[model samples]
Target chain A: MSPLLTFFLWSLLKCVVVTVVLLIGVAYTVLLERKLVGRIQNRWGPNRVGPFGLLQPLVDGAKLFLKEELIPGNVYKPLFLIAPIIALGCALISISVVPFGGPFTIWGSPNLFQISDVNFGLLVILGITSIGIYGIALAGWSSNNKFSLLGALRSSAQMISYELALGLSLVGVGMRAGSLNLRVIIESQTSNKGLLSWNIFGGMQFFAFFLYLMAAYAETNRSPFDLPEAESELVAGYHTEYSSMKFAMFFMAEYANMITVGCVATMLFLGGWTSPFGNLVPMPHNTFLLGLVQAFGPIMWFVIKVFSFLFLYVWVRGTLPRFRYDQLMGFGWRVLLPLTILNIVGSSLWFAYHS
Target chain B: MLLIIFILFAGLCLAGAINLLLQTHPINSALSLIVVMVSLAVLYLTLGAEFLAAAQVIVYAGAIMVLFTFVVMLLNAGKEERTLGSFASWSVGFPAVAVILAVIASVLIKSQGLGTVHLSDKITSTQELSAMLFKELVLPFEVTSVLVLIAILGAVALARRGDGERKGGQ
Candidate 1:
């Protein structure tokens, strides 16, 4: 095969693998949330599906798929059909640029554990996520339902407001790394001091991380900030009119976004796939053993970090009460926005002085 | 490959523009405008202006068009009826646009310095772009930001006045 053909095939294969893994991850995240929240609420969650509800997501998927798809009367046809796709597409697209493991050689060519290593991977993610608001917005509008519209309006306002803080909180990290590339950003966190060198510790970005976490929670419409889909008020929010697989798409998109957010948090603040011990943990000198460790170690660390982050997400969901709509808006703008700006300035000064 | 992608996006951009004009419903038109903005961003990427491309998507297609959609949705605007143009506008607008296009085309064709453009493979990094904006064109950049700030203040002032008048009336 020509070099170009080989490259194309490899990329195609990588895309397939990453996508399948992500979908599985999203499915399992749903199970994890249900189980965790159930435990928190003093009840069992999906115990019968398969061994602690391991097969719950698959069964849920099949049920959603087999259910009757409903296209409500008096709804705008095109946009109603297209909204969930836009949401899910944007959610999945953002993950394409995230690196899950360290680089490894395949077929005499070096490859990162991501589908693409765009120069502005971080910016691409932000842009795609910002675009994702349209999905909820359009879904509500096209649904022609008052509850859906109100939910979407609140969601759009909340998301756009929180996005400012979310984007600004990362500016300090980007400034420290001196690049927008995800891999470079992760590598910049490397240090013999290990956990201390991560942005939240020695980098003095714990405040920014706090801002990012809050904003991320708000951005994903997770607990405490989930005013958009508040069950009491909105009755399922933007996907109110959607049924069957369409509703599943929105559900999957939400979980997928959570996973993506977790991945990004793992990368930006937790030093990515690097161990907390860093170089303190010695590796094997033998080539074969080194290769095996190198291939698996970073990935294991990455999964652990991401899993913990998701646990935190669920924990917060169980612990906190949802913010009122006005409070959500006020906190995003009045509190988070200014603090993030302050963090940028403070980090800039710190980096300059330290350098 | 770049040329093909450019042509595809450029065609989509033009199609979206036409669709924007053709669509009677305000929401559809707004969505078409988004399509135009996104395709144009892709065209910018094809030209190797990565930062500009990202900004176009984030700022124009994502933020601005979203606000446009928000407003349309809030107003619950329906399909507008098509009407024939007035004689005065049809006579003046077409000739004026033609004259402007003619002038631009003539200038481009006649200028010796305006050679055929080539798309280079070299990508423009954000650092270089920032250097140009902050270092070489610092005054203009600051001036532009100040201008935006002024516009924002003017809007706020207008909104506040409207609120005060409403409160006084109440």
Candidate 2:
């Protein structure tokens, strides 16, 4: 095959694999969310679905598939239909640039674990994820319902406001690493000092990481920042009029965003896929499996880190009460924004001094 | 390759402008604006500023345009007003004449150049463009902050109710 054809086919295959894996991940994330929330609330969550409720997400999927899709008469038909697809599509597109693991040797040529390694990978992810907000806004507007419109407006403002903090918070990470490439950032974390050399504790990088986590939660519209979907005020927020698989798409998009944020946090702060103590303790010389183990090290570390963040997401959802709209906005614009700027200035000053 | 993409992008831009003009509904006009924004982003990509292109799409198309569309929807601005007598004709005629003149000037300029400027693919790629933006175009980059400030002042002025007009308030 020609190189172009090979590249095309490789990208296509990677898309399929990532889509399947993400779909499964989205499914289980809901289960994990519920199970974790249940434990926090002192209740058994979906125990009867399968062994340890492993099949609950499957059951939930079937139910959503079977549910009736209602298109209200007042809606702008075309836009209403297209909104969810756009949301899901943008959400999924971001994963392509993310390196899940280091390069794997494929058919004699070295194949990178990611679908594509664009030079502006981080910016692309940010761009696509930002675009995902339109789906929610459009859905609410197209529904032609009062509550939905209000929810959509709130969401649009909230997202734009918080996104400033979210983007700024990562500036320090980009600055310190002196590279935008995700793999390069990850590789920088590994050294003889082990994971302590990771960006989280790499001098003043922790402030940026903390700001990033907070802004990330708000960006993903998780608890305390989920006014867009505030049940008491706006019925079901943007997707109030939606049902069936259409509704499921919004849910999946949220979880997918969670995963994306988790992955980014891991890549930026937690040394990506690098083993914590593995760097400190050198391996025995010249073992075949040692190479294999080291090869898979980052991927394993990345997965574990991502899952831990996901759990933190659930824990926050369970523990914290939702923020009122005023509080949410106040925190975003007043608190987070200033802190992010401070973090940036501090990081820049620290870098200047150190370098 | 860059020229081909640019040509396609220009066509999309024209289509989007036409849609904005011809489409009766405000919502459709908003959607067309998004199409225009996205096309501009493609143009940015062809010029090689991938980061700026992405930022353009995300900030303008994704965030700002959504706000515009939401406001349009809130205002329920689809109703057509009956055309005022000769004012409508003047509105259509003057803009058309100006556009025609602008097009003629552009075509004349293109013909005068005689295709001396061979559009290099390397010059239009993202890395090259970004280097140009941050290094060579730094002044214009800083000037954009002034432009944004002007826009802010313009918006505030437009939104403020006149003191003289308040005398007639109920």
Candidate 3:
């Protein structure tokens, strides 16, 4: 194949595979949240479907697909349709930049795990997510409903506020790694010192990580930060007017955003694609077994780390009560922002002194 | 591929700007402006200024525009009330704007040799930009930060209601 053709084909293949995997992942995430939250509430969640409700997402997807698409007469029609598409599209596109596993040969063709390894993958993810606020905002406004608009507005405000802490928290990770590429960050974390060398272990960014954890919860519109769509207050919030698949898109967007944030946290702090033992685990000499290990091992570790973060998301949702409106904003601005600034300054000095 | 994307997004930018003008409601105009800002970000990416592209999206399209939308939504802004065009708007205003656009287009055409960006001319990485800002341009950067600090203070003072007023409204 011509180089350009090879590049295009490889990218196309990666995009398809990533999108499919991510969509299925998002579906199961919903199932996971329901089941886990159900357990927390002392209930069996969705056991009616195939084998402990593994097929629940499939059933839910079908129902959404077959259901009616309603457009209220009062809606500003064009934006009402476009907002959820943009929301979901932005959520999905952020995945294209995330690194999942190491490179390996596939049927004699050498392939690296990521779709595209941009130099500024982290910032690109940040920028894409920052734009995601539009979906909720436009959804609420275009819905021509007070509750929807209020929900959307609150969500946008929360995201904008928390984004500062989120972005600042990552700077410590990036600075420690000395690179913004997700792959490079992972490589930096593969310490011979085993698990102790991961950013959260001996790394000084633990406080930053804590800050990021809180901000990420708000960013994903999860509970204790989910004031925008709080059932008692906003009455379904931004998606209140949405029905069927339109609502489903917003629902999937939330899960997808959660997954994206989880992946970022894993990549930055928990050592992405690296085993707990780091490079200490001896590799088998057999090429085929090694290949299988290399291919699946990293993916398995990554999924485990990501799953842990998602579990944290659910745990927080179950554990904490949602913050009141002014309290949420106050915490974001008065607390998180100042702490992030302090962290940036402190880390800079720490790095300089250590160097 | 480069030319294709440039044409596609440049057209989008123009379309977005035109939409901003044509939209009746303030919210629609604000969204259109976001479309333009996002298109500009893409243009920056194509021009090999990745940092600027991200900043364009993050700061302009993301932060500032969200605030604009918030205010517009909060006010429940309706479609802009149309007014009768003055005789001078069609005669003097249109021509003046047209002349300005023509001059800009002429300068742009003349600068094609300089503006033509080959793929190899790409400088999308942030290293050089950061180096330039932190090393050679540090003073200006600090000055800008100070300016921003002042602006924040000004905004806070202006927006904060006095203790006497706060309780009365509540």
Candidate 4:
């Protein structure tokens, strides 16, 4: 087979696998969030549904599937339908560039864990995340409801505000690493050291890291920054009028975005897949098996780090109160914006002073 | 294969442009504009400009198109039939001139053997593009930023005028 044909098939297969995995993961994430939050609140979450509510997500999935879908009489039918698909598709496309594990040999060919390792992987991810706003905006607008339009407008403004900080915060890391390829960034951290060598602990990169985390939380429309979908204000936010699986798709996109943000945080500041204290061990540096072991060492660590961040997201949801719309906007524009700018300048000065 | 993809993308662009021009509904025209932008991005990809293609989609199709759609919906411009001389005369005239110019330009390029022009693969990558933007195109890029700033200032001025008018009326 031609190389192009091989690449095409490999990408297609990876897409299929990732889609299936994310679907399952999304279902389970809902369960995990509820159970964790329930524990935090000292309340029973969903014990009625099969075995401590292990099957609650499945039941919820079934309910959404069986529920009657609604389209309001005045809504723009085509755009209303297309909006959720766009949201879900863009959410899924971002996973293509994320490296779940190191490369391995398969059928006498080098098989990489990522779908495609583009040189501009960081930029691509940023671009795709930015595009997700349209899905929310369109959904709200197409619904032809006042609440939906207001929600969409709020979401667009909120997303655009935070995205600036998010992009600027990453500039510091990108400058320090001298590469935007995520895999390269991960490899750089591995060769340098482990946890201490990661960008967050590497000099003043932590400031950018902090900014990124806050901006990322806002970007995903998670609680405290989820004013667009605040049930108390706009009913259900952008999906106010959506029912059945269409609503499910929006919910899936939100969790998928949460996972994407977590993965990106892992890659950027958490040493990606590198073991935290791998440098402490006196392993040989040149052996093939040792190299393989070292390469795969970070995968588990990466997942654990990402899961902790995901847990933080749920914990925050249970603990903190949502910000007022004006307060949220002010925080994003006034606080995070200047802080991100300072991070860039500080990183640049450090680079100049050191090198 | 590249040519095939290019032709298909071109067809989509043509269809979208026609829909935008001939359709009576402003909302339909806005949607068609999005289709045109997407097709343009595909055309960029066919030329091996992947970064450019993604930027085209993100900036034009995703951002600007959304703004256009929003404004169209906000205006709530209802459907109306296109009369014979209702903006069609200028539009048709410009397109006719554009076609004539395109035909002349293509003939000149063909006669000059410009079809043999080649682009080196190295110069097409994102790194090279960044280098070119910051180094060679720095002046023009900075000028564009200034232009955008001026446009924003003008918009603010116009908004202030509108507010002043409302206050005067009250």
The Cα RMSD of model 3 versus the native structure comes to 2.7
**After superposition, which runs of candidate 4 have C-alpha atoms over 4 Å from their true positions?**
A1-5, A282-296, B86-123, B160-170
Best by lDDT: 1
Query: Lowest-lDDT window of 10 residues in candidate 2 chain A?
Result: A103-112
Model 2: per-residue Cα lDDT at residue A324: 91
Model 2: chain B TM-score relative to the native chain B? 0.62
Candidate 4: residue A106 Cα off by (Å): 2.2
Native contacts recovered, in order, as a fraction for each?
0.58, 0.64, 0.72, 0.31
Cand. 2 TM to true fold: 0.89
lDDT of 2 by residue, B1-170 (tens): 67898899989998999998788778888889888998999887776666778789878987788778768867767745545459877999989999999998899887864644443533343456668889999999889989999999988786675644676684
Q: Give model 3's docking category.
A: medium
Give per-residue CA lDDT, model 3, range B21-103, as digits (tens). Answer: 98899998998999999999988888888889889999999899999999999899888988879898879998999999999
Tens digit per residue, CA lDDT, model 4, A107-155: 4334556778887788788878877887898898889898898888888
Q: How far off is residue B57 in model 4, in Å? A: 2.8
Ranking by lDDT: 1, 3, 2, 4
List model 3 lDDT by residue over A279-349, tens digit each: 77899999999878989999999999999998988888878988999999999999999998898888888
User: How well is each residue in A1-355 modelled by candidate 1, as lDDT tens digits?
Assistant: 8888887888888889988999999999999999999999999988998887899999999999999999999999999999999999999889999999988777844475888889999999999999999999999999999999988888888888888899999999999899999999999998898898898887889999989999999999999898889999889888899999899889989999999999999999999988899789899999999998999999999999999999999999999998988888889989999999999999999999999
RMSD of 4: 3.6
State model 4's lDDT. 0.83
Worst ten in a row by lDDT for model 1 chain A:
A103-112
Go through the candidates in order and give the clash count of each: 0, 3, 0, 2
